[model samples]
Structure formats: structure tokens, C-alpha cells
Target: MTAALVEEAVKKAAVAWINVGAGPARALWCLPVDGTLIVVSGPGEQTAPELPEATRATVRLRGDTGGLIVICETAVARIAPGSEDWAALAPQLAAKRLNASGTADDLVARWENDGCAIVRLTPATDQPAAAPALPDDAQAAPPRETPARVPVRRPFRLHRVRRR
Candidate 1:
């Protein structure tokens, strides 16, 4: 899918889960590469479980600073198909085209093995886009042209009084 499509899917999914606090915070910035979602988290954030088959899936969160919590297949088999929350969330997930990938299957297996629920986000059709590349010798834009500073001299009268 196109970058625009992926971006749209992410935006929609983010909006749906932002209030619910159900997806990975750091993974929000992650993009799918080589059939896996690459997420970079701060030092203390929890590490994602190793995925099984590396399938495309929606990611979700349970806490603010706990790192990405869950990843799951796009299909909502375990989740009730058409509840109010599910209905509301489905479009966003659909937008991303979430689906089971080898990676996703692996994640599910890991979660099951660890006795953790697979966190899922709204599916997206396209994977997130790669970050813009920077030139090797890229330089900061030239500082904005500024007027030369003019020294101001204040004229003041000094009075000296002799005290007897």
C-alpha cells in the first residue's frame, strides 16, 4: 500500500486507541520493515516478545511507559466481531490492513507462552513509511541573516562633590 494509505491508517488507529490507551506508545512511531515492525523504545520500556512467523499485525499498549505491550493479527477472531468498541475500532484496523504475518504469529505464540494477552490495534492496510533520508554532509540551514549589532553610547554627566 501507499505511504499515504499507511499514514492514514496509523492516524485513524492512533485516534481510536489514544483515549483507550491500548497500543504501544513507542511502536506508534515504528514502521514495518522486512515483514516486521521495528519499534525503538527508551531504555526502560518493555521489550517486545520475539515474533514467531513475522506476520503483519496491529500493536496496542496497556501503560504509558511500559513500552509496546501487545501485537496481534489483523483479523479479530478472538475479539468479539461486532461489539460497539470493536465496530468503532474496526475501520481504523481495516485502514492499516492488519493481517497475520509470520512475525505476528510468533508474537501470539510468545504471548500465549508467557500467559499474556495479545494487544491489538486497529488494522492498517499499508505498513508505515520509512523515514526521510538525510544527506551525508547535510548542514544546518544558514542562520537567519541578522542586522549587525550597533554599539550604543549613553551620554551621562558625572558630578563630583567634595565633602569637607
Candidate 2:
């Protein structure tokens, strides 16, 4: 896919997933790199294990026919067709790998023979601009005053006492 197309797809696909391995399940940002996807497994406060550049992968799709086979690297991975393991791993791989740096044929070959897949690299999505602040000179509206409460008193009543 073209760089722009890849970038758009990555942007659309970029999402946060829970790292279940860690207790309490932490959130991580899945960023798309040039030829791989980077998963910020945890916020800066928490430290995560340093993963290797390559490992076995399984790709699975939601409500799909079959899974694909793949191999995952630091920020990239390769996918092969007709691999159930690859399908099971696709979501995680896609979430982690965004950039398409290598050629499609190379990626396919890597998967078909070596049990790996090629992921394209895409540009990071731009954040939305902040809203403009109101001018200091803008007149402040006066606060509305609440009505004061009044107390009600009942008049004293006198009754004639009957002698027993």
C-alpha cells in the first residue's frame, strides 16, 4: 500500500489494548512505526520487559474464516496466508506493527517459508488542536443573587378554661 494509505490505515487501527499478562491489565498505546508497530506497554511510570526483535506469532481475525501465520519483531512482523496461528496473532500484531517498510513479496515470502510476515510502516496520526481560550478583556458576567428567606410566626390563641 502507498505510504499515505498505510498511514491512514495505521491511524484508523491505532488503539489501546490491555496487557493481560500484567496484573490488573494495563493499557498501552499501539503506535505505528515505519516498518513495525510499537506497543507502549505501559505508561512511563511502570516498566515493562524489553521484548526481542523477533518471535513466533499467531494471527486471528474476528468472525473470519481462518487465521494466518506470522513472526513478530520489535516493531514489525511478517504474515503468511492459511495459518491459524497467524490469524490469532493478527490483532496483537496489527496493534503492534503498523509500518510497511519491506516489499509485499518479501513479506509474503518471509511468512510462507520462514513463518514470518511483513508489516508496513505508517505515519503517526496528528492530535486535534486545542480550543482557543477566551480573551482576558472579555467582560465577566455578574452572578445572580438568591432571594432572602423570611420566617413566619403564628399569632397566640386564647381559650376559656371550663371549671371542673
Candidate 3:
């Protein structure tokens, strides 16, 4: 019953916050395939440091209302490019990627060329994946430091001169 809930929660959410090892939880777009979640990380992709090397990770999914839904421990497996699994799954992942620059094939090629890590996250059967209850306090944290910044607005011409 709990496993079903985990699967249902995962199926509904497009993104999940994954914490690999002792690192901070990072939001990653996920693709559900064959009862597992597929996540890609590397250069020009989402940042998930140590995910490919880590054997285990914690996956947190949010509800439709944007609230916490379920938290699960997942077994991580890195799928090598050019493998049978990669061949089948990469196209699916590329199709699901929103705002992707190129065709699915092109994106897959780029992923391959850039040496991206395609990881499969399987929910662990032994560990409890679901949270007992929703917490009363708001789960908010200070924003992480980044070099990227918002750009200034361009000048607007409010009034137009009337032609004689």
C-alpha cells in the first residue's frame, strides 16, 4: 500500500528534490519509466553533484497544491551512454525536457557528447519512503549563493510624438 502511494506521488510530480549523500537537496526534473525515476545531470544540465557516484539518495515529491507529498529513499544506478538502457530511455527523457533547445536526437547527441550522467532512481523496498505527516512549520530556507543575477529592465518610451 505504501509503495503504491510512493509510485502515485512520483507519477503526478514532474520534479523532485533529491539529496545525494550529505549534499543539499536540489530540485531536478524527473522522467518516470519502468517503475523508476530517470534523472540526467552533468555539464549544461541540472546540477546534482555526487549523484552518479552515490549509491543512495533521498527523493522528495510535492503535491499538486505545491506542498510536500512524499519522501522516499532511492537506490541510484548510473546508466552508461551507448548502453541498451540509455538508448531506450534517453529519447524519452529528451522529449519530456521543457524548453529544450534542439530536437530529441540532437539533445541526446549533446548529452552523449557532454558526457552526461543518466541516473535511475529506484525506490528502496526495505526503507520507509513516505513521510508520516505534513509538518506544521513552513519548510523554507535561505537562498543559495550564485553568480547569476536578474537583468535590469530596458528603457520604455511612454509617450510617442504626434506626426504633423
Task: Indicate which candidate wins on lDDT.
Answer: 3
Backbone clashes under 3 angstroms, per model: 23, 29, 0
Per-residue C-alpha lDDT of model 3 across residues 14-85, encoded as one tens digit per residue: 899899876788999999887789999999999987899989998888877887877789999999999999
Ranking by lDDT: 3, 1, 2
- Regions of model 2 farther than 4 Å from truth: 1-11, 16-27, 41-54, 57-164
Candidate 1 local distance difference test against the native? 0.35
Off by over 4 Å in 3: 129-135, 149-164
In candidate 1, what residue range of length 10 has the lowest lDDT sum? 14-23
Model 1: residue 129 alpha-carbon error in angstroms:
16
> Tens digit of lDDT per residue, candidate 2, span 94-147?
344346446544443444554333332222223211112212343334543436
In candidate 3, list every pair of residues with a backbone clash.
Answer: none
Ranking of all predicted structures according to TM-score, beginning with the best and ending with the worst: 3, 2, 1
Instruction: Give the true-structure RMSD of model 3.
Output: 5.3
Error of 3 at 9 (Å): 1.1
**What is candidate 2's TM-score against the reference?**
0.22
TM-score of 3: 0.84
